[model samples]
Target: MKRTLFAAIAMAAIAATSNAVLADTPSHRDAVAFVDQAKIGQNLPVIALSIAKQTVTFTTIASKLGNAGAVKAVSDEINALLPLYQPKWNENIAQAYEKSFTEEELSSLASEGRSSKYASKVLAQQGVIGKQMESTSKPILTDLVTQALRTVMSKTP
Candidate 1:
């Protein structure tokens, strides 16, 4: 219960700040640019997954772990933070840039905790349940991003 309360407040504060940062009349590309500026590493795939219109929905896992409130709160927080990550969408573009990657680049970006510093910062307070939620969410985020990208980037759907 205490964790839930703390997580909720923390997420709410983050949401508020992210929105405040963007409140100065931002553009879509401004958001996209944010995502695009990220360096390739552990964060690339996660950013790719995110830009493909994918998401992390840990609500069920949260509930099972007695943190449903925290889950919802965090989910909402991500929605709010989406704009901030908009520019780092290269991972999504990497499909086209496959030729640019050697085997090592691909391997490097996908390793466990590849983006440990950033990932840790983002996941700083996540408990066992939250980590479980992240592990479980990857596939779902991948599928959703693939579908959305197909629809948006292709001439014929």
Candidate 2:
């Protein structure tokens, strides 16, 4: 009885957390717009295909694992998984774009991205912006990781 009650409570907690996460997720349409503004779709297909190709190798050991005379197992598995992976890749890209940009930024970006001059200017400054972030964040992240590792190590011995 106690175990069953605990399991029910745990499930309720997980469901509540899931609902909260879903509620916080940005609009999918806004995410799609953000992806378009960022030109993420232009290279998404090529990147997804490349990643899928590599992923095929990971699950191709069915023959070696003795899965009952599996000659075309690898090929069959790859074919089956490709369709599943493509949509996930697109969804992940959309989610990333949504999480990274606010609705106002996405709206402005959609309009500005259509302008060649604006895009060119933004593209030119992109590298500088990345460098600025790297400079500002590297030290902070390094310190955080170092401290975390030291804590773990100290706790161990």
The clash count of every prediction, one per candidate, is 12, 0
In model 2, where is the ten-residue run with the lowest total lDDT? 11-20
Q: For each candidate, what is the lDDT?
A: 0.34, 0.37
Per-residue lDDT over 50-102 for candidate 2, one digit per residue giving the tens place of the 0 to 100 score: 33334332234322443332223333443444454434333444444344455
Error of 1 at 97 (Å): 39
Which segments of candidate 2 are over 4 A away from where they belong? 1-27, 36-45, 48-82, 111-157
Question: Which pairs in model 2 have colliding backbones?
Answer: none
Candidate 2 achieves a global lDDT of: 0.37
C-alpha RMSD values across all candidates: 16.0, 17.4
Best by TM-score: 2
lDDT score at residue 103, model 1, on the 0-100 scale:
36
